[model samples]
Target: MTPNDPIDKGDLLNVIKWAIIGIVAIAIVLAAMAGFGQLNVNNVITLLTILAIALPIYYFVMMLRSSKVTKVERSRVKAYIPLFFAAAIFWGIEESGSVVLALFAEQRTVLHIGSWHFAAANFQSLNPLFIMILTPVFVWLWEHWKKQPSAPGKFSAGLVFAGLSYMWMALPGMLFGTSGRVSPFWLVGSWFIVEIAEMLISPIGLSITTKLAPNAFRSQMMSMWFMADATGQAINAQIVKFYSTDTEVQYFLAIGLVSVVFGIIMFILVKKINTLMEGIH
Candidate 1:
């Protein structure tokens, strides 16, 4: 067919129909499992989280296959798939500064220094505060540095740092024990580390999303970046249930290890991912 000819819609329609059927089937099975007592609240949420991550990806792949997308475009988008998940995992930890970290600040941290006292809610400001402080420094660094890591490399490093933030929280419980209130610096430090990860992942991820987007689905691709954050928070809703005074150390260690391990795995795959990116550095 000529380049001017309209692409066929049949494949796209079929993909939509199949995707809906598949999602419905998975949801029904999960619900049935819950009804039969095979799934607890956490189990249900975990599976639903997988579904949340997978569904959009399923549609994205189908759309690419059905459309008039080029090989180069397809490869770049494929490269973006792994990065998307990495961003989601990073966001899961980063966004939790408000929910999980805030809970820690309120319930576990000692909120005073010397004669100074502050609200636990005030701790939330540390995120934006650190971002503001670090942004210019990082901008200058990226500009002056002749060699920088690829987006995937930055993301991998970001995940490690994100994981370390959680791991750092585990230390307060470990060193001082999990019962009494610890110093507020622990919370501040965790926020500081995760915000560093945010600097590595957030802006870089946004830039790479624009660079990698297919011309036909430019807007949708950007939406997918936001969707990554949403997906992370959705998963957090389930995992955060496991956190409490007694489970504090275990919770932090578990989530932190997961992020760190995934970061290492991503690092190992960097060369492969770079190849998939096809020169969009």
Candidate 2:
């Protein structure tokens, strides 16, 4: 349609509704923060971060409910909803590589290997390093494995692996005690495991997002894929506050188990979720 074409009344009204909601939400957050003396740079950044994640998700839901979305498209979008949340949870753990995990590397682990000292920050490189190493291996495996899992199945497994990565972190604190530094290998092992989870979820998630997208909202669905990452990081900002040297083991176990339990539930409901997919697989 040309720019000169009149905007539909319903569309204009919907846009206005969202604009008003956003303004009020921001105002409320700011007022609450100011009241508590928490209206600072970091807290404001967190608020913006959550908004960035939430808006796209809200938009995606609205898109699915649009009159242009067909019955089958609506069903597929319904199936996509579970996957989106699964992705968000998976990412919350995976993205913590730079935040919670970084803190572990810096504060908990011994940053030396037999007198060859290194920077704790160096541990961050393990994420991309492992991704490069694992991507090709997974690319080959997916081609040769004949009976690969569906996207939902892969996402479930990814969550388990991501959970295990945190569970691995809990062990060093559990065995060695959190007051003293443990081996840096603990961080190494955790990064390795989470990267394996990424191999399952990241690429497959991108491909599946494309497949599951309703025709009218194709590009918007891809944005929804990225919003999962934002949502996870936004959650990370709040949850990371709970992660300290004092609460090391409990924090790791709590978040880890949540992902694992959700994953197991998803696995049990795989058949039901697939049915909702309406043969997209």
Candidates' C-alpha lDDT: 0.89, 0.88
Superposed model 2: Cα runs more than 4 Å off:
1-38, 42-46, 49-57
User: What tens digits encode model 1's per-residue C-alpha lDDT throughout 1-281?
Assistant: 33333336995798699889988998898789878998777777777788777866775786479465688989988999889999999999998988889889999999899999999999989988999999999999899988899999999999999999999999999999988999999988999999999999999999999899877667778889998997898888888888999999999999999999999999999999999999988
> Which runs in model 1 stand beyond 4 Å of their true positions?
1-51
- Number of colliding residue pairs in each model: 0, 0
Question: TM per model?
Answer: 0.84, 0.88
Top TM-score hit: 2
Pairs that collide in candidate 2 are none
